[model samples]
Target: MNDELSLPATELVRRTLAHAKRLLPAALFHHSVRTYLYGRLLGEQRGLRPGRDYDDELLFLGCVLHDCGLSAEGDGDQRFELDGADLAVRFLEGEGVASDRAQVVWDAIALHMDREIAERKRPEIALVALGAGFDLGGGPERLPPGYTDRVHRVLPRLHAAAVLHDSIVRQALENPRKAPPFTMQGELVRQATGGSWPTWEHLARSAGWNDYEGYRP
Candidate 1:
């Protein structure tokens, strides 16, 4: 499925990936790729067609760059989602992408954490949150049969839930702005600091995957 809907990487996608690789961790980067794959699958499930309902390249960019805030280059005195969005937009500017397209990716990354709001937006934005939710144990029965095993065989999960959750908690601890109250990062930070949230560790233990080896406690 590396064909990405039977299309090769456009120049923009190539540039986006190159930039993202410089910022994202290996595990997170792979998660980003899987996000695109899963998002595409979910779109197809909902009868949405790429290049018609939305731009496929934009979807790819949004999914891959959605976590840039977790990277040092993208870190800032703001929520990770916002920071990540800003960083992605800036990178897009460097690639000479139009402002409107860049804004789509911005909204996708920034709102991917908000199910209610994101689901109300355009597919370009909404699909991102849905896909991320799916990857994190939502709608497991809805995914196509054997899809997880197939994609994961090519690109390992690397315990993405555990990795992503802990990264947010750690960064939020170091810089409080990154985990402002009411956000997921704030909840994760609280969890790591003896408070509790229904965290990825909880999800992983309950997921029955029996393959979680990241982030203890």
Candidate 2:
């Protein structure tokens, strides 16, 4: 990793995933981590570079910490974003980032899932929110009327997002333990899926186990 860009984002994401591993269902952990990474990759693709006004280190840290609240409970409430944002505000403030920049991170978290908020915020935060929305597959239906036209102007970014999403899904399948069993094999199929059995088969296939036929779910 380049020292100038600093690998803080990756490191922070790794640490956050590790921490979630100990507490969350494998599927949920994988989903959340992938979602965060998707946001980061999408942001980069969009040319929405993090400005010097905020430390890249802090931005990465904020991105990694952005979804921690989801681990606290299992619900689709947008409040999860707010909880994560509040946590980031405190964490970044302690890390010596200015209040204004910290607020940028907080606002990003708060509005990540809400396009209406994106329309009303600073460009920096709006960029982050755009990435988050894209990660959730928020098509033009979720955006305001003219937003899609504006976003279409950035073709490369959209292409990058599609590629990144595919990569993340492949990685998740390769490591079944990282994803919820149900996600890998729907709830109806979990019983037929076989706990560690499916995981082993997945690992084997990933490890080139073409002839190793075993129970598959």
Model 2 agreement with the true structure over 172-210: per-residue lDDT tens digits: 344433334434223323443344435655766788758
**Candidate lDDT values, in order:** 0.84, 0.50
lDDT of 2: 0.50
Model 1 lDDT at residue 94: 85
- Screening candidate 1 with a backbone cut-off below 3 angstroms (N, C-alpha, C), the clashing residue pairs are none
Task: Tell me, by TM-score, which candidate is best.
Answer: 1
* lDDT accuracy of residue 9 in candidate 1: 69
lDDT of 1 at 187: 76
